[model samples]
Target: MNDKPAAPAFDRHMLEALVCPVTHATLSYDAERQELISHAAGLAFPIRAGIPIMLVDEARQIKADD
Candidate 1:
């Protein structure tokens, strides 16, 4: 059996339905970093392979300019 779970496929269109868990603001996708940025909240939600990790506890705190 595989030790790690496979990443789920994230549909780009689905981004429209996603909002920042903290601020309830829209998110912008960073293709290079594979993350969803919530500038309002100053947080970066990581996108693993394709699936986005939306949990606030798992998100990385980011600088306003980042």
Candidate 2:
């Protein structure tokens, strides 16, 4: 049985305020991956169940490398 609460759906206003933690840049939501992608920084922050994974640790690094 799924024990997680359904994540709250974000509206346009909230999406506008969403930013990359690393670069503090704008993010584009990818409904497929349920992630907030920062193209400039090349990072894709995951969203679980519906809630966004805003934490750096939880985020998946994109084209950018260490």
Candidate 3:
């Protein structure tokens, strides 16, 4: 049996509608990292099991160098 979990598939339609919870700005999808990046908020929201966790508390703070 395959023990590895399948990668979450992001829906384009949903991505188009998602925005930053903090800044309320448009979000950009990072397929490689499976995250939704909010340049305005400087945070990256994680996508788990094909579901986007848009909570500000759950987001990762992004550094300027990153």
Candidate 4:
């Protein structure tokens, strides 16, 4: 029997409703990285267990090269 907890499922509908807290711009989902990318804010908000951490303090600054 599997003992590990199931990972939370990401909802596409919810993703469409989310915006960047800093820029109030639309966000793009990076499914491979499990992050929400904000081009206007130049930050990437991480999604842990399918729950997006939208706080800027918790987000990673995006590089030009990225």
Candidate of highest lDDT: 4
Q: lDDT of each structure?
A: 0.89, 0.78, 0.87, 0.90
Assess candidate 3 and give its lDDT: 0.87
Off by over 4 Å in 2: 1-12, 64-66
Number of the predicted model whose TM-score against the real structure is largest: 4
User: How do the predictions measure up, each by TM-score?
Assistant: 0.81, 0.70, 0.84, 0.86
Candidate 2, 1-66: lDDT as tens digits = 979876676554668778888888999887767788888778888876567778888878787542
Error of 3 at 7 (Å): 3.9
Model 1 agreement with the true structure over 1-66: per-residue lDDT tens digits: 768985666688978999999989999988778899999999999988788999999999999888
Q: Write the per-residue lDDT of candidate 4 for residues 1-66, one digit (tens) a residue.
A: 879997797787887789999999999998889999999889999999989999999999998567
| Between candidates 1 and 2, the lDDT winner | 1
Which window of 10 residues has the lowest lDDT sum in candidate 2? 5-14
**Model 1 misplaced stretches (Cα beyond 4 Å):** 1-9
Give per-residue CA lDDT, model 3, range 1-66, as digits (tens). Answer: 879977769896897788888878998888888899998989999999889999889999998556
Off by over 4 Å in 4: 1-3
Q: After superposing candidate 3, which stretches have Cα over 4 Å from the reference? A: 3-5
Candidate 2 to truth, TM: 0.70
Q: Rank all candidate structures by their TM-score, best first, as comma-separated numbers.
A: 4, 3, 1, 2
lDDT of 1: 0.89
- On the 0 to 100 scale, the lDDT of residue 41 in model 1 is 97
